[model samples]
Target chain A: MELLKQRINKDGDIKEGNIVKVDSFLNHQIDVELLNEIGKEFKSRFSLEKIDKILTIEASGIAIAVIVAQYFNVPVVFAKKTDSKNLDKDTYESKVYSYTKDKTYTIRVSKKYLNKGENILILDDFLAKGKAAEGLIDIINQSNSNLIGVGIVIEKGFQNGGKNLRDKGIKLESLAIVDSIENGKIIFR
Target chain B: MELLKQRINKDGDIKEGNIVKVDSFLNHQIDVELLNEIGKEFKSRFSLEKIDKILTIEASGIAIAVIVAQYFNVPVVFAKKTDSKNLDKDTYESKVYSYTKDKTYTIRVSKKYLNKGENILILDDFLAKGKAAEGLIDIINQSNSNLIGVGIVIEKGFQNGGKNLRDKGIKLESLAIVDSIENGKIIFR
Candidate 1:
């Protein structure tokens, strides 16, 4: 976590509307080395839980979840944002509102992927409003699978997403939590 | 490669319109172990080339590229399909026509990631019409980067994608090239 926080402070770009762009290393262009460390840290944090599979949302979370899954030795199932013809007809669906894009989109996973009573760990790159996390959780619940915990690379502490998940008694582990971004300076919690 | 072929023969769903769905292990629900093998095979195939970075398109390609990057010990940079505000203003863009989506979309990579003269290896999950690969190649050219080769997990050999890339003198390494799907039977070349 210290390494991730340091990397964020060094490379993360702060923009208007509290957007912390770690595109240089985290999301857009990825650092596999850093992701491997993140994987190790998450494994250590959730070592006690029984994680059958890792679930995430598409576009960005796929990289983080796939890399982190290496340590857990588990398969990863990503919820697709679009209704592609390739996707299965029977799926567990949830609606997510993206403040960045200013639209609500449906995220779905094939019903064949998530089975009942399977232990699942949800992972993602950023946790801001918790809409994406909530959507993934909804899909997990619908599948009748057990939600082990949520692992996030970066969390906006000023936002309510992290707090909301914690309130639901979800074991949320955020590697780096930015308490605030003031005048281009990122304050970590 | 044998393992991948066996996986496809066993779990790949042959749907109408010549669609071979490997969502059971490749894209939607990912088998990290199989992906690791894929990484090793790619590394072995492109072992002689000096790969500075792994470039791929977003969504499914991210998982394969990241896992493959482990073997190469390099970073992975994915092109964004949508024009998100999070992406940089200055980008290397190219248009790709998706037959499945029945539309042409622009894929963008930031100017910072793909440096001029850097060696890049493009990796992806599927290579059908080669439009996606062509788009990525165009971005690489715009950035003045060197494209060492393109690695595909499954190449529809019956399609023109593989032939087109090879015709241009590009090193194309497809793990399993499916010659044709004959009455739900996948014949690999």
Candidate 2:
């Protein structure tokens, strides 16, 4: 986590309105070695828990989840953000409000992917308003599956997403927690 | 390669449009052990070439490229399909046509990640129309980087992507090349 925070300080870009971009490693361009380390860390933390499947959202989270899934030795199901010709109509859907993008989009996973009494571990790149994570949790809840925990790479600590998940008694582990961005600088917790 | 073809035969879903969906273990739900095998296989094939970096596109390609990067002991730079807040303005962009959706989209790589004269190996999940592969090649061409080769997990041999790339004297290797699909049956070359 220290390494991630340091990398964020060195290469991360801070935009206005508290937008933090770690594209150099996290989003746009990826550091595979760092991702392997993160995977190991996640494996160490959640290895104890019985995780049936690893869940994440499409685009950003897929890379990290795929890396993490190696250690867990499980299959990864990424929730597609857009409707595709391939995805079945019978899907468990939920809406996520993206503060940065200023809109709500439906994230869906096929109903066949998640099942009853399965232990699910949700993973994602960023947890802001917790909408994305909550949406995944909502799908898992609908399936009558057990929501084991939520793992995130970066959490906007200033935002209520991480806090709300904690209040609801969901086990959340964010690798890097940003306390605030003071004067266009990052302050980590 | 035989294993991959066999896996495809076992789990891949053949749709009406010659679209084989290996979501169970390839794209939607990834198998890291299989990915590890793929990474090792890619390294074995491209071991002689001095690969400076591994390049791929977003979504499906990210997972394979990241895993393969470890074997090459290099970083991966995935092309962004959208110009998000995370990506910087300066980029090497290229247009890619998707056969699945029957649409074209622009993919961008940060000017920082890809450098001139760097040796890059393009990796992706499927090589159908080869638009994605060509798009990556275009970015590599623009950056003045040497495209060592292109790696693909599955190839629709009937589609002409691999043949086109090969015709241009480019090294394109597909793990499993499907000759045809008849009556929901896959015939591999």
Regions more than 4 Å wrong, model 2: A183-185
lDDT for each of the candidates? Answer: 0.94, 0.88
Report chain B TM per candidate: 0.98, 0.97
Using DockQ as the measure, the top candidate is 1
Candidate 2, residues A37-88, lDDT tens digits: the string is 8998888889789998999987889889988888887888898877778887
- Per-residue lDDT of model 1, residues B93-138, tens digit only: 9999988778889999999999999999999999988999999999
lDDT of 2 at B131: 91
Best by TM-score: 1
lDDT for residue B104 in candidate 2, whole number 0-100: 84
